[model samples]
Target: MTTPLQPRNTAMFYFQAWISFATAMTAMGIGIAYLPVSAWVRGFIGLGALFLVTSSFTLAKVIRDRQETETMVNRVDQARLEKLLSDHDVFRPETV
Candidate 1:
């Protein structure tokens, strides 16, 4: 199996992503706050937004962790197979 390549994120890209996320969440929050409705509705909307953000973070972490685990397991298995192949000798006499 081939080794996994590390992914690199540029500072500009990171800044852009952070800015986009912050801008989106801030806009939604302001929109919800200024909505022409009662406080109950706004609170409910805020709760939903909280859930969405938390779930999104949780899901992303879970996916990232699973991928890392898979890569590590594959590397270990590949190493074991390589060691086995290296140590094996065809046509060697068997010990009694």
Candidate 2:
């Protein structure tokens, strides 16, 4: 029997990821709000930062979804293999 995959450090992983994302966003927001740069430059920087954060989130979600799909496929394959093995008779006398 194949052992199930256990999600270890899931909470910690998400926590760290969120913390870093928040820190970057907060720093960027503060800089944009307080920096002496021209309005156009500030707007450009803000839009760029927003795009980056949005893309990162979308990429993470896509990766996670792909992993889940792969895992489900693996589980289904395992089940089929187990069923096949169970249906086979190992000790029966063979007749030509």
Candidate 3:
């Protein structure tokens, strides 16, 4: 069985992704803060934005965790299968 290739991520790519996310969030916050609306409306919209951000983060984390768990479980199963195949003595087996 072939080994899985490790994912490669450069520091520059990480930095750029963080910068883009920060810039978008900053712009969104500024736009929301400056909108012509009453206090209650602004507060409601702000709350919605906060909820969206938190939920998005939670969703991303959950997805990543699930994928990692699956990868780990698959690795364990593959190792077990390999071990079983290696330990069996085909030539000395009594069963037909």
Candidate 4:
């Protein structure tokens, strides 16, 4: 069976996603740096921000993986259905 062409991703979508992630991390880092807090507090905030960034990336990857898996399953199901239908005989006389 022939597979359909996937849709093309525009540069704008990538640009926007990158800018948003960068902006969030930058804002958090700057905020942690300038806050008048103790060393431990600053360290905690920095660590938390780092964790957030890492988790966000991980979450995005997981979601993308799940979507790809689902798409593959759907395609497989479609192909199976098409094959079954093609192999079926419609005009054969049925025995009661």
Model 2 gets an lDDT of: 0.88
By lDDT, the candidates rank as 1, 3, 4, 2
> Backbone collision count in every prediction?
0, 0, 0, 0
Which structure among the candidates has the greatest lDDT?
1
Which residue pairs of candidate 3 clash?
none
Residues 1-96, model 1: lDDT tens digits? 456678899999999999999998999999999999999999999999999999999999999999989988988989999889978988799899
**lDDT on C-alpha atoms for all candidate structures:** 0.93, 0.88, 0.91, 0.91
What tens-digit string does per-residue lDDT give for candidate 2 at 1-96? Answer: 767767677788989988987898888899898879899999998998899889988998999999989988999999999999998889978889
Best by TM-score: 3
Supply the global lDDT for candidate 1.
Answer: 0.93
Clashing pairs in 1: none
The TM-score-based order of candidates, best leading, equals 3, 1, 4, 2
Q: Could you give the C-alpha RMSD of every candidate to the true structure, in order shown?
A: 2.3, 2.2, 2.2, 2.5
TM-score of each: 0.85, 0.82, 0.87, 0.82
The candidate with the higher TM-score, 2 or 3, is 3
